[model samples]
Target: MKEKKRILLSLFRKKSNMFLLGILFFLLFFMLVSVSIYNTSRDTISAIERTYGTSFSIGLTPDKNDMNQWEDRAIEGMDSPVRTYIGPNVDEAMVRRITEEVEGITDYEAGSRADVMLYEYELVPGYHAWSYNYFTTHEHHLPYDPEETKNMMYITYTYHTRNSCHFDQFYNGAFRLTQGRHITPDDAFKCIISENFAKRNHLKLGDTLKIDLHSLNVRAKYPIESLGSVETEIVGFFELTYQQTVTQYTEEIDILENWVITDNEAGRALDEIIGRPYYLSASQFFVENPAELDEVMEQVRQLDWIDWKYYELVKDDGLYSQAVKPLRTLKIIMAVCLVVIVTSGVLLLMLVILHSMKRRKREAGILMSLGITGKEIRKQFLGEHLALGLTAFFFALIVSLAVTPGIGNQIYGAVNKGGEQKVYTEKEIEAAIARGENSKVAEMSRNQRTGVEPPKELTTRVEVKTALLVFAMMLLIVYYSVNEAIKKTLKLEPIRVLSMIE
Candidate 1:
C-alpha cells in the first residue's frame, strides 16, 4: 500500500500536472460515454415508436354512412362491373372481381347473415338483427302498429364467414368457445350458437335446429323463391366477452348477441333458398403492413373491378394515432442528436490521447529507474487512467440519466407545439375511402393489428449492458495509450530517463 502511494505521488508531484490530467481525462471519458448513451437511447426510442406507431386498419367496410361519398361520385356512363344489392351487402360476382384484381392485400375474410324465427312467438336476433322483444315494443315494427306482435313471424338466417377475420362485431371483446370447437371456412353444414341463446332455447351441442326460409315471403304475398325447412347441425356454442354496439345510420344487424356463425357455403344455401344469388354483408382485407395502408387503399380504388356504389374501403387509423404521436416525434429528434454526438466524440478522444503520448512515455521511464519492475510500472500507469476514466464515466452516466429523458421530451414537445398535440389532423391520402374523397386523419398512433398504445414518454435509461460496454471500451482505449508509452520506455535505458535533469 505504501509503495503504491509513493509511486502515485511521484507521478503527480506537480499539482499543475495532476490538475490538467484530471480535467483532460474527465472531459474525454464524459464525452465518449455521454455520446454512447445518446446513441443507445435513440435506437430504443425509435424501435418503440415504429412498433406501436404504425397501427391502422384497411378493409372492405359496410359503412353505409359513407355510401353517400361514393354514391355522389358514381359515373353512370362509365363501364364497370361491381355493384351493390341489398343496402350494405355487395354482389358475389363483385367480390370475386376484387379477389382477382386488387394488389397489396395480406389476407381477407367475407361474411353474410340472415334473420329467422325459431318459434311462432320468437323472432330470434343474431349478429346485429333485432329480436322479437325490441321490435315488438317499437311502433314502427308493422308500418302500422300491429295489435300484438307476440305471434308475428320474422326472417332469420344462419351466418357463414371465412377465417382469420377481424369482424368488428365478433372481435370486440372476442368470444370464448364454451362448447365444441370453431367452425372452419370449409364446413357447409355445421354451426355455432351464442351461449345465452343456447341456454334460452334449451338446446345443446349436437342438436339439430330447422330454419324455414320461405315463411316470411309467403305471408307478405311476395312470391317465395323457394320453400322448405333446412336442418342445421349445432356444433358449438360461444360466450360473448364483449358485444359491439352499432353506430347510428349503420344498416348492420349483426352485433354478436344470439348471432349464429357458420361458414360461407351454408350461408349461401340459405340465401339461395330466399332468392339472392350471393350477398356479402362485409369483408375485411388485411394489408401486409399498417404503414403502407394508404398506398394499398389507393391501388385498390383504381382497380377495374371496384365500383364505389357497392363496396368501400374502411379505415380505423384514428383509433390509435392520438395515443403515440408525441413519442414518435421524440424518437426522431433523439436519433438525429445521437448521430452528431457520437461522430464528434470519437475524433476528439483520438486527437487528445495521441498528443499526450510523449509525456506518458517519459513517466514510464522514470518509474523503471526507481527499482520498480516493468509489470508494476505498467500496472501503476493503467491504474491512474482507470481511476480518472471511471470517475468521468460515472459523471457521464449521471448526466445521461439526468438529461436524456428531458432532452428527448423537450425536443418532441417543441416540435409538437408546446406539448399540446391537436385532435387528429386529416391528411389527403393518395387513395379515396369508399366515401369517395376522404382525408386520412393522424391521431395518437398505436399498433393497428394489436390495438395497443406505446409508453407515454420517450424511454431512456443507462442499462447494465450499456454501462458495461462503455466501461470496457474506455478500459481498452486507456490500455492502448499506456501500452504505446511503455513500449518506448522499454526500448530506452533507465539512466537515459534520469539524464533529463541535466
Candidate 2:
C-alpha cells in the first residue's frame, strides 16, 4: 500500500501531465454530450414536422358547377368509371365508395360544414340575481357565447363543422386527446371541445349540449330554423397553447375562439342539411419513403375523381425538409466545432507529454544506469499518463451530463417559441360542422390559431453501449499518447546499457 501511494504521488506531481489528461477527457465528454443533445434536438424537430405533415390547399375556380363537364368527361374516359370530382357538398357515402375503388388510398375523411347553434342549460334561481347576471352577462361576452346582452339565462351558442380532407389526412396524426377520447366514426352526433371553449362554458366530459341549425334564409331576423337538433356529448377536451389560438380575425364575421377540431361524421350531418357536396380545400399524403413521393403523386393525378386543376397532391417530404433545414445546418456547425475540439485536445496532450519527456530525461538516465530495463521504465511512464487521461475523462463526462440538457432546452425554446403552444379544440370541430357561415368561421379559426409549437423535448438515457464506446476511445487515446511518451523518454542505446552511474 505504501508503494502504491508513492507511485500515485509521483504520477500527480507533474502539473503538465494533470492538465493534459484533463483537457483530453473534457474534450471527449463535451463531444459526447454535444452529439447526444444535437441528435435529440433533430429528433424533436422531425416529430413536429411529421405532425404538420405536407399541407396543400386546393381552390376551385368559379366553383364545381363550372368544372362539372370536365369531371364528367374524365369519369367517362376511365376504363373503370368512378365518381372523381368531389366538391364542397360531397357526402360520406360517396367518400366511402371512392375509398373502396382507390388502390392507394389508405384513409380519407370528407369535409363539410353547416351553421348550428350550441345550446347549454342555464339554471338561475329567482332569488340569485348576481348569479343570474354572472351566468347570463359575464359569461355571455365570452367568444363561445353568442348572446352576451340578454338576461334571460342565455346559453352561448357557436357552430361546429368538419373539413373532410383535413379530417381524413390528419385524423390520427395531428389530433391527439389531452383529456378525452377522439370523435370516432360512431360519434355521429358527438363532439369534442377545446380546452378554452370548455373552460369558458364550464363544461366537462359526458355533458350533453344541444345544437340548432340555421336555414338558408339567415337574413330573416327569425329565419333560422331548428332543422334538426343533435345532442353532442363532450367526448374530449384539448389544451390550446397560446400559439394555437388565433389572434386575428380577417373575415366580416367575428369567431368566438380560434381553436377547433372535429371528425367527418358531423360533417356528413351538415351535408344532409345543405344541398351541395363539401370537400376539404386541403389534402396531405404521407409516404414511407421520400423517394416514392413522385410515384404516389402520379397515381393521385391519374385518378378520375381528382380534379388536377382544382386539387393538388401534397408530399410530406417537402414539409420535413423545411422543418429540419435549420437543424441540419446546425449539425454541420457542430461537426466543425467537434473537429476543432479534437485537434486542440490532441495538440495540448502532445505538448504536455513532450514537456514531461524533456523534464524526466535525467531520471530516465539514472534508472538506466541502475540496470532497470528500458521497457519496464517506459511501462511506468505510460501507465502514469494513462491513469491521468482516464481521471480527466470521467470528470469531464460528469460535468457534461449535467449541463447538456439545459443547453439543449434553451436552444430549442429560442428557435421554436411560437410553435409550441397552439392546441385543437371541439369548438373548432363544431364550427367545422356548420357549412357556409360556420365553415367560414372554422377557416378563420385555422388562420388565426397560434403557430404550431416545437415538439416536446426528448429525454436521453445514456446507453451501456455508448458508455463502453467512450471508454474504448479514451483508452485508445491514452495508449497512443503514453506509448509515444515512453519511447522518447527512454532514449537509451541498447548496446551501452551495462554502465552503472549510481
Candidate 2 C-alpha lDDT tens digits along 1-502: 2334535876767777656766777777866766666666556566655555533222344354565533532232235444344443334454465456645555544444454444343322121223444556554445333333232222222333333224432233333457877655455666665666676678788877565454421222322344555556777775433333332222212232323344555544555664444454333334443344466557656678755554444443443454455566556655676678767776777777776776766666766666777876766676776677677767767776777777666655565455432344546545555655765544544533223423454465344555566677677766777677667446655334323222
Per-candidate TM vs. native? 0.45, 0.56
Error of 1 at 208 (Å): 2.6
Quote the positional error of residue 124 for candidate 2 in Å. 19
lDDT, candidate 1, equals 0.54
lDDT of 1 at 77: 30
Estimate, for each residue in 1-502, the C-alpha lDDT of model 1 and write its tens digit.
Answer: 4557854674566344455355545554444444444554456545544443232322344555755434422323334433342344465555555656667675566777666544421323431233344565665535433323332333444567775134443442256677787766567677787777677678888988666564443344332223655567888887755433332211122334445677777667776775766667656556666567678777777886455655567665443454446555554554565455545544454455545545555665667776777778677766766666677677766776666556655554465553432222122222223335432311111101223233434445556676687668667766776676466566667777656533
Number of the predicted model whose TM-score against the real structure is largest: 2
Error of 2 at 6 (Å): 11
Candidate 2 C-alpha error for residue 103, in Å: 9.6
- Per-candidate local distance difference test: 0.54, 0.52
